[model samples]
Target: MLKWLRRSEPKEVPAATLGPLQIVKPWARSSASEPDVGGGYMTVVNDGESDRLVSASCSAAGSVEIHAIRVKGPALEMRKQDAGLVIPPANQQILKPRGYHLLMRDLASPLLAGSKVPVTLVFEKAGSVTVDFAVEEPGAVGHVTLRSS
Candidate 1:
């Protein structure tokens, strides 16, 4: 009797550390009814002593703004945060749906699911790191996965 041994498949982990910056779980998707207004969520961990997200830009939309969602008397409101998002040392900030997020308005074209959209996140210390956001369905949560890089 001969026995055969099986080998485990290797998992392809994403490359860690893109330049001086480390991006954690960046995700973006379009909203229902209004496809032009896309939403982006992500976390950035600044390994360096000092750094913060100054601004963000994307070719997928005409304008991108950092916003926060609030509920006032049963009304859902989204407002722009002029102070820019901050990433503290050894800390993380979460950008999620119906919360703090990157509001992509006036999309140049339609963004479909499974498609990748290029976005550039500018940091005050680490500079700019460009990454592709995997698009998903509207109101879809927890689809965005980010590793160090």
Candidate 2:
């Protein structure tokens, strides 16, 4: 029956959720140098009441801020979202490249591939939810399915 030839299904990484807010496929880009800046990406799904992603923190970085890109006179600049990002009820907020993402500044150490970064996300309604973000290779895009190492 060629049982050994059967391909295995890719295992999906676990998502963290508190109440109606679920953090899916959280990931961060790998850094090659110390004190580097990085971006954190993820999708926040709200199944019940609306919530606001107020802030985030991690041991890997000194500061984390929610940022959005805007065009200004033939140039692109990153602006901090002072009011934070909103996730409406029954909706989702996707944090990706060139859009909304977590700006990690003053990195304590290089974030190498295959490592995981534990981040605590504070929401207005959902409270604080800590999730481990899988570190991917440099310039990695889209959701990544992690394999157990």
Candidate 3:
């Protein structure tokens, strides 16, 4: 019967867009030895109206936390990100050393320089995005080796 056939047919759904956040020049840095921890840096350009980086996760590390650094007297201090990393309208959020960065804690294995790592960032508006980060030498010039291709 036509009615039975129609009922059994699948319905078509519209495809969804990826998101508005664009990750640029992602990179990672780790210690010389079997590093159990490391730092992640990148620039998040928000094409959407606005969004917030709620959290991040790294497959290579047991825990990944969003962090920021503050200039404390003659020294700089690093700590967890309060609230969240906010992405303003058509603005960019930067993550770099001595600034806003990701702390990879309790890594399962060592992450040597020149290695690539996968990280997922969860946003309030645009949703989640997984990107690759190219590792660089510890004293590399401004993490210039980072590339997002």
Candidate with the greatest lDDT versus the true structure: 2
Return the clash pairs for model 1, or none: 25-146
> How far off is residue 136 in model 1, in Å?
0.8
> What tens digits encode model 2's per-residue C-alpha lDDT throughout 2-94?
566778899444489799888999999853432387889999888898899999999989899998865455554677888999988998899
**In model 3, which regions exceed 4 Å deviation?**
1-18, 32-34, 139-149
Assess each prediction's global lDDT (C-alpha) against the native: 0.72, 0.80, 0.74
State the lDDT of candidate 1 residue by residue for 1-149, as single tens digits: 99998988973333235544566667788877576788988766555565667788997688888887765554557778777777776665778886788989899876788888888888776777787877887763333322221
Candidate 2 residue runs with Cα over 4 Å from true position: 1-14, 30-35, 71-75, 140-149
Question: Which residue pairs show backbone clashes in model 3?
Answer: none
Model 2: lDDT equals: 0.80
Question: Better model by lDDT, 1 or 2?
Answer: 2
Sort order, TM-score high to low: 2, 1, 3
Among all candidates shown, the one with the greatest TM-score: 2
**Per-residue C-alpha lDDT of model 3 across residues 15-115, encoded as one tens digit per residue:** 22237767878888874443677888888876678888889999899988888777656565666875778988787888988788887888887676778
lDDT of 1: 0.72
